[model samples]
Target: MGKNLLFIALIILSGCKGISQEEKKEDKDTKEIAYAVSKTDAEWRAELTDMEYYVLRKAATENAFTSDLLDNKEKGTYVCAACATPLFRSENKFKSGTGWPSFDKEIEGNVAYDVDYKIGYPRTEEHCATCGGHLGHVFNDGPRETTGKRHCINGVALDFIPDSK
Candidate 1:
């Protein structure tokens, strides 16, 4: 009887441990950190379209091959749509066949990364450093000639600025 009670207590404690860990993670994710550009949730929603708000603020993904920028080949810099911070340069862009704007590298210091487990596995999620807007993910499969990193960015998260002749 004592052993049975101890076993049940142990099981309950382990379940509580998992819940506490999940709560800690939620708290960490919700803690606000100061960025170069910060806005209230209402302001962000008012400024961005529904899709943009979903992808940038809520970390939702757009459908592959649905971005207007997927086929863009013009020379320019890609800036964060939320904060207009320069992210990837045209020279770093490449055809990754992933239906998203792929860059071998980002303009230094403009992007930040965090681990995302939304899909049941860990992925490196990139975002604009200035406004903390979700941009996309980074993968290791990329051109060997450069950084060997594929920065797969969301079109709705970026705005292209054509280079002057």
Candidate 2:
């Protein structure tokens, strides 16, 4: 019966090790990141609407073709809804027909990026550099004459400021 008891001990030990590793990974993922426009969860909730909170803080995507900015042709700057940081210019905007607003490029130094595997594959996730709010994704399918990069942004994440004439 000694062999049986040893096997049981090994199984328990292996299980515990697995749990410890999992916990470490979880902790790493949820670790706090301080941003230039840092705020508590309660503060963010108080300031943002439900949809804004979901899209900016929780990194949720809005439905395609639902953004009022999709057909916007006015000259202006698109800023981050959460922080008002200028993200995209009207000059860089294009009708990508991808439902969401597309930009050929972002206001350089205002956007940040990271890799996320939430969909089981790698995608470049963009964020507002000032507040760390989720903006959207950048893809390679864009005008080759320009940046050749498609900044497929969620409309909910942006606020348009029409240029004063």
Q: Pick the candidate with the highest TM-score.
A: 1
| Tens-digit lDDT string for candidate 2 (1-165) | 999999999999877754325422222147666689999889999999888899998989999999999999999999999999999999999989999999999999999888766775568889999999998889999999999999999999999999983
Candidate 1 residues lying further than 4 Å off, grouped into runs, are 1-28
List the lowest-lDDT window of 10 residues for candidate 1. Answer: 19-28
Candidate 1 C-alpha error for residue 70, in Å: 1.0
lDDT of 2 at 60: 94
Mark the regions of model 2 whose C-alpha exceeds 4 Å error after superposition. Answer: 1-28
Report the lDDT tens digits of candidate 1 across residue range 58-125.
99889999998888899999999998999999999999999999999999999988887777566899
Q: Candidates' lDDT values, in order?
A: 0.90, 0.89
TM-score of candidate 1 relative to the true fold = 0.82
